[model samples]
Structures are given as structure tokens and as C-alpha cells.
Target: MKQLVKFTTGIILLLTASINGFSQDLHFSQFFNSPLTTNPANTGFIPDGNYRLGVNYRDQWSSIPVPYKTMSAFGDAQLFRDQLTYGWVGIGAVILRDVAGAGNLTSTKGYASIAYHQLMGNSSLLSLGFNAGSANKRVDVTKLVFGDQWNGKFFDAQVPTAEPMASSSANYFDLQVGMNYAYFPTDDIYINAGASVQHVNMPRETFYDGDNRVPRRYIGFLNASLKMSDKVILNPGAYYTRQAHTSQTMFGMNAAYNLSGDGNQQAYGGIYYRTNDAAMFMVGYQLSSVKLMFSYDATTSSLSAANSSRGAYEIGIIYTGLYKNRAFSDAIRSTFCPSF
Candidate 1:
């Protein structure tokens, strides 16, 4: 058992170094800035819809033992009108679980945001948003074991070490700011650009053996949609991120076919590819007040040899116009509760 654990740890370390000279961290998607996860500035940016809901999941390095997996769920909505301008608020929660070698780590975070949107010109709008929240992290010491000091005992047994006395958990505060600009030069085309920074205070956490701190992250994205015809459109997008001493840039283009529908609703199918990541295919359908989408990612790296092309899967859903087309469900309730 000791030898097996040691081998597993070594293999994981080697794989991590091979990928980017460090272990992989939790990331929502290669498609980061879709008015969902990237920036608070995107909250309630959708037209006519007062609310939205979304969820995403990721699985990585299946070839290795104890592969990494992540899941996230989020929602946002518009609040009310102030004269010609509008005010909106959003809330999101994320849970991350990482399994590498003999250790397991988990992080749970919740955030709330407020945003204001105002018409800029004849065909443009400007949005500014701010977010504040708290994050909690926990590490179960019993789950981690050193290769040389294991005797097949498990579950609350004395580890013969005094460093980590009990299961450790801590909470910290975080802040974020963002801005977005959107333009619709024509009735059939739209373009948007945005930038966001998270963890402005650089929260410090001591949940692990080393100095485990939540690093400040920056993200930027650009998106454009072009109408090819009455029944087709092309949506191209790019997302860039820098976090924890690592930087990545992803660019992808997707073409969506507008299936026949009525009254501000449609269905679409798209294919996209990203640099240094995977090729993705997506299909989505929108009806009356609900939208659903599914996507599959295919590995395109040398690690493809191990997983044999299977990579990640994601599903998302959104609903709008619940509260008399004025505000979101939670926002409406909160207006009365006044304490949540």
C-alpha cells in the first residue's frame, strides 16, 4: 500500500510539471466570458430577460489515478428600472474538489454583485459592476498520507504527527470589479468587450501545509455575432485569463444555425475550437422562457494518447421573465425579505 501510494504521488507530480510546471487549479471553462462566469458586468445584460441560471462541470486527466473534477452553478438577474437606466443584482456559488495523490482539497465560495447599465448612444450601452463575497476552504488531514508512514489504518486513527491536529477550515473576504461595453451597429450584428479583476484584496488562506493564498486573477473577453442570413448566424469569441503566476489565452469561433422559431425564440447548433485546449461542439434550444445548451470537448493534446480523446462535458440552462417581466425570483423575494 505504501509503495502504491508513493507511485501515485510521483506520477501526479510528473504530470503536473509536464502540463505547466505546476499543478492544475480549478477553472470554470475554456469559454470563460459568456455573460455567465467571467464578469459581474455581464449580469442582467441580456435583453428582455430579467433572470438567468447556469451550471458547468469539468473532468480532466482521466488517464491518471485520482483524476481532477470540478462543478459550478450560478445565476444572475435584473432588478428594477430607475427612470431610463436599470439596476441589477446577481448571486453565484461555486464548489471545487481536487484529488491528487494522497491528498484532497475542496473550496466553496459564494458571491453577490450589483450592476448598473445605461444607454450610451444610439446603438451602444455601458455597464459597470462590483462584487463582494466570502470564500471558505477545508482540507481533511486524515485523507492525506505519507508513503513511508502508513500501516493500513484509516479513519480518525492517530497519525503519529502533531502538525495538522484536526480538519482545518477557514473563511476569507474577496472583492471584484468589472466593466463592459456593447455595440449593435446594425440590427443583425452585435459586439461586446469587457475586462474583470477578481480577489482584489488577495485573500490569505492557511488550509494546507504551505502558504495557500487565493491569488488575484484577471480576465478579458471579446464577443461578436454576425447574421449570415435569416436562418443562420456566426458568433466568434475570445477569452484571456491570468491567475496565480500562470497566463492563458483562448480564442474560438462558433457558427450557429437559427432553426425556425417564433416570438424571440430559436434553436442553434455550433462547432468551435480553442488553442491549447479542445475542440467543442454545442447545441442549444430556446423556447418561450427557457434556454438549454449542451457541449462536449475533445482532447487535442499529447495527453490525448491517455484519455483517447474524451475530455470534458458541460450543460447550461437559463430562464427569464419570471416576475412580471420586471425582476428575478430571488431579487423580488429579497425586496420583501430585506434581510438576505
Candidate 2:
């Protein structure tokens, strides 16, 4: 039994590494709320925030036997800020976990980040940021089926599988850096853009004794908000990422309605199209500093035949407000650029 467990674990680990080396990282439909995962520069960025906290959950590919599940939690704080004078400094920490596959492969990651912002104009700024972390991956072999168990059209546990295994788990250090720019032309307009490079050091990530490095990933994104009237606002954005030979692109727009013309209590809905993959529908509500969001994907690709177009469902919640900085009266009303 021990030998069988080791053999199955080895094969699962090998496959996981091969897939991870080329595919982009796990993603969330409400990517905007999970700021730190997208870019380090997003940490502690709110209009005039003292601190921000967020939690996210995702359930993907329910059509399959074993679904992919993820959960994340993070917090960020403003270490220093200077109205429109000397820019600012911020710091944050994040932890997330994901589990998938018939073998129940699991991954856990934790990271800390810091960023510095430089004033560009009266209403514009540029930010540079860095993060360091560790990722650990493991697998359970009890649920796996071995091909060698098949003998003359029937499975036989007495037969020797003869599979060799080196290890069943591994951990690797990870690093990323990013740059972001934001411009608030008026009370009604906001524009922001950024780029990031992940796995820059390409540390070893294989479970086996051999050396295998995590591939480098490049990401780019932009977002904007336009106020059309006292009750209506428009938000549009796009995000693109590439890892080794695999790439993904997603674009969409959101229509938001202000309930009392103050822009504090709001509701929004949108459709996002994933290139050659699926169309995602999202809806959310925001009251003052708290937001609750939900989304579901309608598969449109070749996989639709197997799953009847049902994909993933996701949920996100966040809270952002001032815990300090009581000096500036207008600070809370400031229009700042968050990664969202």
C-alpha cells in the first residue's frame, strides 16, 4: 500500500509541475477585490485609507468529478501619506490556498509586499512595488488509479506496479515586482494602468530530485471610470497575462447605479468575455465601505460539450476605510486609484 501511494503521488506531482510551468496562475472573477494578487502596487491603495481587508472564495469546474476550490485573505495598511505633497508608502500581507484534481493536489502561498508612490501631478501618481513569498504544493495519492493495475482487461492488485517515486511534495520561494500609474482628471473621471513580472527568480519547484524552475509570468491591465450622470456611472477594464507558452485575455464593462446620488450606496452588474473560453456575469452591492460581489461563468469553448456551459461560481467581500488620519477633513473624499 505504501508503494502504491508513493507511485501515484509521484505521477501526480510530475503532471502538476508540467502544467504549472506553462499555465498562468489561478484567477478570480472579482480580480479587482483581490488586489495584492494582481499587483503589489495595489496594496493599501484606497481613496484615503488607513487600512483595507478582503476575503475571496471560488468553486470551479463543478461539472467535473473533483472541483477546483480556492480561498484567500489579505490586509493592507497605509504607513505614511502626504496629501498632494510628498507621495506615500504602504505595506501588506496575504495568504491563499487552492485544491484541485482527482489526486487532491493542494497549494498554499503566503506573501508580504511594500510599495512607494511618487506624485506625478496635482491628481496623478506613479507607484513601484515588490513582494516576496513561498509556495508549497502537495498531493494525496489514496484516490488515484494506476494504469499498471489493469491486467488482461481486469484490474489486479496482486500485480507489481513497478512505479518509482522520488518525492511527494515541495516548496519554493517566489518573487514579483510591478509598476502602476493613476490619473484622476476630475471628480468624475479616473484612469489607471499597470504591469507586473512574477516568478522573477525562477526558483526550483519540482517534487522530484531533478531541478525544475517555475516559469516567469508577465501581466498587464488597465481600468477607467466615467460618470455619465448623477445616477449612472460606467466602469470598463481589461486584463491580460502570459506564462511561458500559455496566455489569457479578459475584457468587460460594468454599469453602476447610485441609489441616493451620493455614490455611497450602489449596485452594479456586468458581463465579461474571456477570449475563446466563457462569458462571465457579475453582480455586486456596495454600501459605504463594504462590498459584496458574486459571479458565474457560462462556458462557451469546446469544453461546453462536456459540461453544458456551466463553469465556475465565485464570491468576494471587502472593507476599506480610515482607522487613522483624522487630520484632513477632505481626505476621505479623495478620489484615488485602486487596482480595481
Give the lowest summed-lDDT range of ten residues in model 1: 331-340
Q: Write the per-residue lDDT of candidate 1 for residues 198-263, one digit (tens) a residue.
A: 888877776555666667789899888877776666778888888877776766665555454333
TM-score of each: 0.77, 0.88
**What's the residue-level lDDT of 231 in candidate 2?**
84
Residue-wise C-alpha lDDT for candidate 2, range 280-325, written one tens digit per residue: 9999998888888899999887555555677889999999887644
Q: Which ten residues in a row have the lowest lDDT in candidate 2?
A: 331-340
Q: What C-alpha lDDT does candidate 2 achieve relative to the native structure?
A: 0.78
Model 2 Cα RMSD, Å?
Answer: 5.7
List candidate 2 segments past 4 Å from native.
Answer: 1-23, 82-84, 152-160, 328-333, 337-340
For each of the candidates, the C-alpha root-mean-square deviation to the true structure, in angstroms, is: 7.3, 5.7
Candidate 2: deviation at residue 51, Å? 2.1
